[model samples]
Target: MGMIVPSLAHWLEASELLNGKGMFMTGTDTNVGKTWVGKQLIHTLRVLGREVIPRKPVESGWNADIQQTDAWQLANAAGLELDNSICPYRFSAAISPPRAAHLVGKHLTLQTLAATCPTRWDKRQFLYVEGAGGFYSPIADDGLNADLAQILGLPVVLVAENKLGCINHVLLAAEAIQQRRVPFAGVILNNRQSLPESMDNLNDLRAYLTVPVVTFPAT
Candidate 1:
């Protein structure tokens, strides 16, 4: 049978780009499958005999009853326990993390968030960090996700929901990342919904983007 998701080759390329350090995963927008792609990447790295450490640092829209916050899911993907070390700032409001932090009389800073990520890297160990929303979305009281990406200095993997207008979103985000001079690993177009085969969003993106443009649920 054909591969149902991204091929091993794609993951291998990603691994090489990461060079055993890890990647900062962001999305073009919320619900663009950043967590989903991060989980898959973690799994693929494990299959390649690499240790994966996943971090969600800060998450909004957290509900203890839900038990499925982004941080929880990321820790689960890495086979680690849910703890403050993995995610230190979690708010109940379903808004930008900085706004959510404000709702509870908390203030977050880019430095504080960046400090949560692991600095030490061992051979065959990967550290995966997922941002709260889009690349430019506000993540701290003082910075956007782009700012945090600059601080961490890890290569970025942008995930965009595949559908109408994704080309614009992907390109705009790519330009922003380029402006920041962050190492852009690639773009992952997640198929959250089926599109007409004639749409060919993948090729359209590849035509414009110089970086690798891969599709989830590999078309």
Candidate 2:
């Protein structure tokens, strides 16, 4: 069939956009393992001999250790050299960037983040932009991570953790994707086995959703 609707979200309009450029990655909610799944995809893509650049547009809860965060893991996973530029905004609190920055005495701005996109990552490299928190998650004082994804113009892959009541959460996110008109790149049913009726739920999702979904099994 044609591209699954979810796969279409955050998708590059021009293959030329990501022929060797980058992809933007986002998630459903906080601590949903965006980094874990992103690390594997970056590593796998890198092994296939493509240049992959992973970035967290906004990150919070940094420990002053480069190797500790998700961005670092993606850098290492893709076998690329690490640098602070990979993730632009680092917040101290373990909360949303807007709230976290408030606790740290600074305002996080979308303009600051939008400025980082023009830099050349690699000629044929993949740029994977990871967002902090879910679609509706607060980014700036007035915006959320979904806004960040919209600014990037890259199709987005949403990692929907399959915990209890995920159908509501994931479907709500899908609606937001549609409402925003951001490229919809399908959902990764993270922790596929966690839900008691995961298979049943997934079938329900597939039946109603216009996008294609893939549930990742454990390694």
Candidate 3:
């Protein structure tokens, strides 16, 4: 599909509809710091006195002892207690949400995934919905991460790991996002490792994509 970049007016309209309180965070690839960046954003928003509700629609590779799941980490970051609203589907296996659901004898549908999210708008609390794995990663039997993001109708914050081949990944993710006509906020480059090409990739991405590209230092 041909990429179609939306005008500023489109984003403005979405912001108005959402009451300027919702966004989707998706990564270029797995372990690309989507949760880490999300945690930082939640912390920053909380510091600014905004009540933030973090959601990871589906999570895999659950750890019982540490409660170490993407959704748990995000919920903790927002200073909110854990609940189904934060993460609807969770699996112990380390795999994609759809596959994990399949292994558990449960079918994943886009409708079910959408229904698990917060449908009502709350003026006081901002919503940060994080997607599992990469932007194109499958979350349901028929839908990908981008589809879930589209269904939520929230602006997206694309996260990419700062490393080799990151430029291609970020650009590809951005292209898919553009083609979907999703309200894109911008991109965040997470420096997971210090590499010689880190700064170069950051600059190349800034020059390649029209959207604003920001960096997240190692934590």
Candidate 4:
């Protein structure tokens, strides 16, 4: 089968639905293609002539030698320079951000993480903040990604791997986001593999979720 990229119309609808300062992107779990979906959205926003402010804030599996770190990828997509403001906390260990910070005898707080994001917003600027790991995953010494999402006050966008059990994962994450009272933009089901079950994940998610559910092709 051919690769299935999201149409321009799909992204345009996304821009309209998420018509706010920006969005807080979280995933059902780690490695669910959060960065991939984020890059695509950022690219689309740029094409629409909106200034995109991409922030990863905290990344655990950071390797300075590698140029394709999540922060770098987000930066490259937004056509911005890789700087501390974009990803303030970086650890070489491939673990949770809090655990990675612990390994290096450093501690991160929710306030510090939230402060890294740009405060100023204009009609021409759109903020795209990507959370580390899943929504409940520990991003700082003090809080989970959900907590940061609440603090940022941006509409949450859930990205999940389009595979077996994805419906359960997306629903659970959505519940958590709703519990926090964060505005939910929608869901992006990333088809990274050609799993037979992956073909139906989008429809399954839409049936259970009232928000927009879109598919993203594998890279």
Query: 106 in model 3: Cα distance from truth in Å?
Result: 0.5
What C-alpha lDDT do the candidate models reach, one value each?
0.84, 0.70, 0.78, 0.85
Q: Please give the RMSD of candidate 2 to the true structure.
A: 5.5
Q: Score candidate 3 by TM-score against the native.
A: 0.87
- Report the alpha-carbon TM-score of model 2 versus the true structure: 0.82
Stretches off by above 4 angstroms in model 3 are: 1-19, 197-199
TM-score of each model, paired residue for residue: 0.93, 0.82, 0.87, 0.92
Candidate 4 per-residue C-alpha lDDT over 1-219 given as tens digits, one digit per residue, 9 for 90 to 100: 122235633754754643567999999999989998888888877766678899999998888665779999999888988998899889999999999999999999999999998888798889999999999999998999999999999989989988888888999999999999989888888887777743587777778888888887622
Give the per-residue lDDT of model 2 (tens digit) for 35-133: 887776665555445677677766789868878877678778877676767777787788888888888788877767766566665566777888888
Which has the greatest TM-score? 1
Clashes of each: 0, 20, 0, 0
Model 1 quality (TM-score): 0.93
On residues 1-219, what C-alpha lDDT tens digit does candidate 1 reach at each position? 122234735645743653548889999998888988787777767766678888888999997864578888777777788889888888999999988888889999999999999889787898889999999999998999999999999889999999999999999999999999998888888877889878998898889977888888686
**Residue 90 lDDT (model 1):** 84
Residue 67's lDDT within candidate 1 is: 57
Clashing pairs in 3: none
In terms of TM-score, which candidate is stronger, 2 or 4? 4
- Candidate with best lDDT: 4
